[model samples]
Target: MGLLLSSCVPTSGGLPPFVNPPASTPYGGEYANEILKLPVYPRSRTLDKREFGNGNSRVRFRVEGVNVRMIYNFFTDQIEDAGWGRNRLESEGQNRTWQGVYQRGIRLVRIRVQQEGNSDVYVLEVTFLQ
Candidate 1:
């Protein structure tokens, strides 16, 4: 009877696993004076947007139905096309995270993205010189 009851119970792993940082991760607050025309994926949603000191800005959003590599490529290419040079790119495969930066002269932009383990959502945080 005990063995049967144990087997009947559902396991947490079978359900949706919550990532450490919640799904709606924001780099800045809800509103900003300046709007950063960031490259958003097709199914991306802006969770939060805000501006910081000296015209700097940041945005946090989530992209759905896309792989980590695809998201990384799209954002990096978009940055380069916008005249920002690729400065650094670091990948932590074990942690399922990637950090990249772009620069053109004194203007700089940075992007940090992490894939929710075993999930279809990708959390992205972008900071740009305004």
Candidate 2:
């Protein structure tokens, strides 16, 4: 059953293989102030975050029990409202995944939200452009 399979997925544990340990403070910390300005999904859990020496950074979060479209729209609206210009927006796999690129002055932000296969868990990655 769907409920049984969803329960087996670990929501909290080690970072995904592609992600490295946090090079600076995790979410809600004093590092990478620029990236932290963007809106974070309500009730999402911070999974991994890292800051680069070039003033760029990436943060990942996980959320569940929310419609994927709603999650996608939240970021798009909030990012635009924050004065970021939309460069591109695209969705594929029947809207199971969405990506958007926006810019404000010299800074760029790319947001991607993808459902974990058929599960309710959604992983969001936001990259702050230098």
Steric clash pairs (candidate 2): none
- What do the candidate models score in CA lDDT, each in turn? 0.39, 0.41
lDDT, candidate 1, 7-58, per-residue tens: 7665575643343434653645543312233333543232221221133332
TM per candidate comes to 0.31, 0.31
> Candidate 1: which stretches are off by over 4 Å?
1-94, 104-106
Q: Cα lDDT of model 1 overall? A: 0.39
lDDT of 2 by residue, 1-130 (tens): 9999976665465554456666764655554564345444553332221211133332322222111122223322211212224433444554454456565345566556555444445556656655
TM-score of structure candidate 2? 0.31
Please tell me which predicted candidate would have the highest lDDT against the true structure: 2
